[model samples]
Target: MSALLELRNVSRSFGGIHAIRNVSLTLQPGQIVGLIGPNGAGKSTLVNIITGVHPATSGTIVHKGERIDRLKPFQISARGIARTFQVVQPFPSMTVIQNVMAGAMFAANIRSMDEARSVAMEHLTFTGLAAMADRPAEQLTLANRKRLELAKSLAMNPHILMLDEVNAGLNTSEVEQALDLIRAIAARGISIVIIEHLLKVVTGLCSRIIVLHHGELIADDPAADVIKDPRVIEAYLGSKFAQRQMVRHG
Candidate 1:
């Protein structure tokens, strides 16, 4: 099967500083991939580049065989690439379902309000936010806000979903709930690239793991192999700790 998305030697810079350097990777259809790194490893920058929030300074981004590096964010969303931000920002004044309806109208091209509402309700129900559909977005708890973010993204009819720290602020039980919802999403055949700091979450949920360090791609391997890699260990831990791990394992 063809790749769902491809980034070839992709790099991004802000004036004198390079945020991402020559990172190349591919997302296969129906796969859940973990993107992990220490803080300032450029994980969010890479996501921005993919979703067109920040275009790559050099390299190509291809989705379904078509180049999209230069496309605007809305254009990319319309082409079925959707992302949720690390910081959930909903239209505070809008009702829960109305916020999702905007995504349907904007990205899914649903013009009629009735049809948009139908699509939004389906996504809200799927995300377990149906009971809160009429509530104002600002009134939600942190967990529910995250669910709202997911519902809005799903209403976009995405083929690929890039989640940036979707489980960041949740408690353990809430995180578990989010994991189940994510699994259900992947079951529907939407490819997922989840950026997470929680190693257990990544290892348990993703088939593959990609690690980045200091703006470079250091490791791309199966989840089990990645966690054991010395380079990955050093990136997250320290060089001294990584050496101890290597010697102990050997």
Candidate 2:
């Protein structure tokens, strides 16, 4: 599979402090990648840079053989890259469908308002939000709120979908539901880069896992192997958890 997105030697900084350091990664079509790291590991910073919410200090972002490092967020969206925030963003006053329709407004495929709405409705259904279609966006429970956020991103007709901790704070069953949504998306041939803290969600849903620490990538491999890396264990996965993981492996 060819790379749909590539970040080469990407680096980001805030004032004088470095947030991301010479990071390079490739995402291929239909691949589900897990990015796991401790807080301040530059996971969000990398997402922001890729999605155009934050400009890179220095690097090249290549998408479909074109440079896109400098595009605005909406411009990036127009280029077929859609990302969901770690914190869900829903228009509180709008209905669930309306919230998704807002994202469809940027879609290049749907030509008219009616077309956008139709597509948005389909995406809400895909994410299991059809029953709550008329509910106020803010009225949904936390799990559904995350599902709404995923639906909104899906409505954008993305070639590459970036999710930022979409499973964080969810109960086990809710996380399973969220994982199912992600699997459905991947099955439709969308490349996904998921930044998550839940190891189970990552190991279960992603084909590969990438580990980050101190703003640099330390491991990128199959999900099972990455979890077993000693560096990943010491730096991010604690000793006790690693012990339990080993026991399960054996």
Candidate 3:
């Protein structure tokens, strides 16, 4: 079967700097994949390229068997690809539910205000934000705001969802809750690409893991093996960290 999203030799550069160099990967339906690397590894750059926030400097991007490299950001999103930023920026003036409604309104379908609101409520409930739906978005705590971001993206009804550090700044319990939410999303048939620094979290939730080093993909394999790869340890996670992981999981 064809991949839901495929990047073939995709690269993005700024002036003389190559943020991503010929990185290729595929995301299959309902699969949860992790993108892991140290800072400056071009993880966010790759996500930006896929979401059409930045065009690829070279090579191709195929979504559901259709080439999408040249498409605009909104166009790519309309095709059922949605992403959340590292920073959650909810509309401060809007109520929590209204913020989600905005995403539904922006989609090709869900035209009426009532329809948007209904869709918004469904997502809010899914993300555990139903009770707080009336609160001002700005008033939400960091963890709740992250949930809001997830809810808004879900309202867009994406087939492939790319989350950039969705677990960042979340507490231990919140992180566990977020993991459960992500699992539920995948259970519903959404393919997910999670860019995360937390190795334990990635290993726990992602079936496959892709590691990038200085803009190049160094390893792409099952999460279990990828974590133990020597190159991955030397480049991103230190050898000691890898040793600890081995001892714990062995």
lDDT of 2 by residue, 1-250 (tens): 6688999999998998989999999999889999889999989888999999999989999999999999999999998999888888699999998888888886666668898789888998898889999999989998999999988888988989999989878988888878888888999999999999888788988899988898999999999899889999999989997899779987
Cα-based TM-score, every candidate: 0.96, 0.95, 0.96
Q: Report the lDDT tens digits of candidate 1 across residue range 159-178.
A: 89999999998999999999
Please state every model's RMSD to the true fold in angstroms.
1.5, 1.7, 1.6
Tell me the whole-model lDDT of each prediction, alpha carbons only: 0.95, 0.90, 0.93
> RMSD, model 1, all Cα superposed?
1.5
C-alpha lDDT (0 to 100) for residue 121 of candidate 1: 96
Q: Of the candidates shown, which would achieve the greatest lDDT relative to the real structure?
A: 1
Quick one: how many clashes does candidate 3 have?
A: 0
Residue 101 C-alpha lDDT in model 3: 94
Worst 10 residues of 3 by lDDT: 102-111
TM-score of structure candidate 3? 0.96
> Model 3 Cα displacement at 243 (Å)?
4.7
